[model samples]
Target: MKYEVVIGLEIHLELQTCSKLFCSCSTTFGKEPNTNCCPICLGLPGSLPAFNRRAIELAVTAALVLNSNVQLKSRFDRKNYFYPDLPKAYQISQYDQPLAKGGYLRIETDGNYRNIKLERVHLEEEAGKLIHSGESIIGSDYSLVDYNRAGIPLLEIVTAPDITCGREARLFLEDLRSILLYSGASDCRMEEGSLRCDANISLRPSGSDKLGTKAEVKNMNSFRSVELALNFEARRQAEILVAGGTITQETRHWDEEKKLTIPLRSKEGSSDYRYFPEPDLLPLILEDNLIKEISAALPELPAARRERLKEQFGLDSSEAALFTVNRSLGDFFEEAAGKYSDYKNLAKWVQGDLLYYLRESGKTVEEVDPQQFIELLALLDAGEINRPVAKDLLNEMILKGTSPQIMVQKKGLGRISGDEQLLPLVEKVIDENPGAVENYRQGKDKAIAFLVGRVLARSGGRADPGEVNQILKEKISRG
Candidate 1:
């Protein structure tokens, strides 16, 4: 019997705030371990917790962007757990009354769009990291706990189990990340552990309405790994069911390097993490006007902006889609292209030249130097270099941060556009390549390739092949 995969995602995004949720400590990443922890974050006795108002505003702003219903009354609950990572031994999270509910995010895939119903988007505090040199959370070594990440405000977005396939789930995540970046709520940098995902997946018979035993997969740091982990789990579960073996409901570990899921523990009861309302904090009451204010502040999201870019810039669907995937990347393209009349060439240069250099240099588009990119585009417009030479110069700029003009000078990549400078090279190539010249006169039309090669070799590949080809045809035809 064929099996169908059902998947749901729980995405956790660390809010981009100046301070932690319950204290005034820095929430910035990359600080020295435990340097940013405060009394409230460290759970010192007699320290009172105050909710960060800015954190609430950011969370509400994100909820509005997702079209969620902003709740008038929301409360924080203490989720009790004892771990080295969680400094308080309890995570202050939203349990019953969340900030938003009943929102739906529209995700597009393969020219079709679908909605993933939101269960809730709740506010919570992040745990820190435990770096151990041993295996299985045990064995020989003592672990170092970094409490800097603890108490950082996080938004947990839980979705209904409506996803049907791994590919659809991946698209949902991409769109979700786009929305997060566009909203400016979070950077959504998965590699930095700012944005994380946990997927719950199960497989059932194709025609059955009943849900089967599901497994939760976590520790996937990238979109590619999420899809891969889900796919592997679904296949593994289906094979077990087909062979009449029972699949266990458990929480599994996603071994990213191994590209497989390993059983972590049985998913049965939550006995230890006793959750209760914290006596120290009061209920958060979200006002209607406050919600309205944030709702009004919401910008044109990815899909709407994509449509606008396609229509306003005269770009195709695919071009617009490519540009809008990353907000900063798309902003750079428009910042460069919108000023000029020929956005088509700008699009081509960005996707072809800009994207190529980013790959070659192993850098992100955000890490690119906008001034150098603008200079390269300006050179292409000013006829300082031809297409291939411009590409070489761009590669040099990316690899060495060398100025494009410097590359042109040092590598002799300047175009020979002027006939005065190009004619001597053209004439010399014609005289020496007699067989090719003879072939050109004898109507072996493809011999133009040979003449072009001779001219380029003499010019150290600096001559514009287009001009050389044109100059050669004319020189060979002279009476």
Candidate 2:
């Protein structure tokens, strides 16, 4: 019997705040170990918690963007735990009263849109990082803890078990990351620990309403890893069920090298944390005006921007999706499109050659000057340069940050449009390939393309392709 995979994700996104949630310690990454710590964040005795206003605003903004209902009153509770990374032995988090709840993000899978419902979005303090001497904590002879990440504000987004497979989970995360980036809530950089996902996967009988035993999988540092780990976990659980073995509720660690999930320990429920309201802090009460103000001030999100790109610039869905994958890329297109009226050509070049060169040269869109790109397109549109020459100049411009006009002038890369200059090369190509000339003479018109290619190749990609094609056909027809 086939089994269905039920996957839910708990995403921990670090807020884009300069200071820790309750302390003034720097929230910057890549700092010296233990350097960005303070008494409040380190949980030393007599250090009381103080909430950061910016952190609250950001969290609320994120909730609004995700369509979550922000709570009027939310309180903090101490989540009791014992680990070296937890200096206070308890992490201050939300319990029954969270900041927001009941939100959904839409993801397109196989041409169908799925609404992945969310359980809650809560504000919490981040735990410190653990550095083990061995490959993992399982075999480490010694360990070290860095308190710098401690007390950093985190927004924990818990999704309902609405995902059906690994690909859907990845799609949801990609759309979610785009939304967060557009909202300026977090950088969503999985590499820097700004965004992290822990997946809970279980396998249930096909068409069963009841859920199966889930194992929490951790250590997924990228989107691809999340998809792979969940797929692996689903297969592992299914194998046990097929063999009539019982599935256990446990927490597993994803071994990247092994490409499998390893059983870590038994999973804990809500009671394991022993949560209790903290007496040091008061309950948060959001005013109506503040919520309205934040809602009104939200910039154009990804969805809205996508629609506008399609309507305003007449971009197709695929083209709009390509440009709006990231806000920066869409902004670059819009900026260049403003200077050039040919939206179709602008979109094609940006999506095709610009993206290709950016990936090939290890450069980013930000390094490219939009005006310079527009200049290149203008040169091509005006027949000053052919497509091949323009592509080469684009690659060079990306690598050297040079202007297209200057590159053309300095390197004599302009199009060879003059028939007088191109005739010798054309005659040479026809004489060298008598077969092509004979084929064209015998009414095989496609042979002219081969002869035209030869002519352009002789001109170092500077020859205007349209002019070469016309000139070749005229010469072949006369003979």
Which number leads on TM-score?
Answer: 2
Q: Which candidate is the best by lDDT?
A: 2
lDDT of each residue in 1-479, candidate 2, tens digit only: 88999999999999999999999999999999999998999899999999999999999999999999999999999999999999999999999999998899988887787789999999999999999999999999999999999999999999999998888899999999999998989999999999999998888889999999889999998999999999999888988999999899999999999999998999878798999999999999999899999999999988888899999999999989877885778889999988999999899999999999999999989999999999999999988898988999999999999999999999998888777898888888988999989998888988888888899899998887888998888877776
Instruction: Give per-residue CA lDDT, model 1, range 3-86, as digits (tens).
Output: 888898999999999999999999878999989997899999999999999899999988887778889998888999778898
Q: Model 2 off-target regions past 4 Å?
A: 424-454, 469-479
**TM-score to true structure, per model:** 0.90, 0.93
lDDT of each: 0.85, 0.93
lDDT score for candidate 2 against the true structure: 0.93
Show where candidate 1 strays beyond 4 Å: 135-140, 268-272, 362-384, 396-420, 460-479
Question: Model 2 Cα displacement at 249 (Å)?
Answer: 1.2
The TM-score measured for candidate 1 stands at 0.90
